[model samples]
Target: MAEHRRLFFALWPDEALRQQIAAISATADWPRGARRVPAAHLHLTLVFLGDVPAERVDAVRSVAASLRVAPFELSLAGCGHFPRAEVGWLGCVDAPPALFALNTGLRQRLRTQGFALRGESFRPHVTLARGLREPPVLPDYPPLHWPVSEYVLVESRRGRAPAYTVIGAWSLAPVSD
Candidate 1:
């Protein structure tokens, strides 16, 4: 039997912008056992491909390489909690059509390559914290915006807390005839 790893596609935030978000998250009164995402690991997940065989890594890389979307601007607008009980997060205000299209295209490509995916529609947002005891009331913060230039395929390791490792990255450049 081979080792199984959790994989996903995501867009990491720029260093400066990530730092700014971290500063804001620090001010929030998070719940117990809630782990705030580290500044280095802040990202918007595009697809969650859970528990794949190691042998399939190359195939996944190829699927990512074949993507045809250019970089676009993404902005963080507000915060909210999932289930209104656990999982606090900052929400994306205006996710452009290109962002949805890009995710949809990637899902189609991955499906063609025999990768089973979660059947949920893509909702682009960055997770700020998890395991909250109470719902969060978002503070008044100026919008945080940044250009998304690349998407990465990451392997997530399960443990006391999940840790992510980047396996491959695809740059998004505009198509030319």
Candidate 2:
């Protein structure tokens, strides 16, 4: 039997922003067979819990459900590459402290629940292209800001292209309320 692996949790980008990012990626001369993530799938990943067994999904969800951080506005600015020329991604110029705190708390909670920590330090980014060689110089796009109120746990499948399936989502109540 193929093992069912649980994926990561992230805040999805809005439709307009997704379209804008897609447009930027489309103009880049990506290498052959390099797949661009679909606009609908653009998101800021919070935690990547790779390869959890199907039976453990509920436990992960319970941990996520206990997260207490309130909704906050995240602004996306600037473009950058990852692992050198191999990958390209979009990033927030200024990540609010709340974002960092939330990530740290989630990491701790998931660790207590027995999830493995990603080896690299959390440099939060939304990936645009995989297998990129020479990234194109992009014009400055206007900064994008959005209120993030929820996070979703997604399942990924590798095929001709990488695809994500939402396994569960948890909402964060507004702090002001």
Best by the lDDT measure: 1
Count of backbone clashes, every candidate in sequence: 0, 0
Relative to the true structure, candidate 1 reaches a TM of 0.92
RMSD (CA, Å), candidate 2 to true, equals 2.4
For model 2, state the Cα shift of residue 14 in Å: 2.4
Model 1 misplaced regions, further than 4 Å: none
TM per candidate comes to: 0.92, 0.88
**lDDT of model number 2:** 0.78
Candidate 2 Cα errors over 4 Å, as ranges: 29-34, 175-177
lDDT of 1: 0.83
Error of 1 at 42 (Å): 1.3
Error of 2 at 123 (Å): 1.1
For residues 121-154, write the lDDT of model 1, one tens digit per residue: 7767788887777766556899998788888888
Provide the RMSD of all predictions against the true structure, rounded to 1 decimal.
1.7, 2.4
Error of 2 at 15 (Å): 1.9
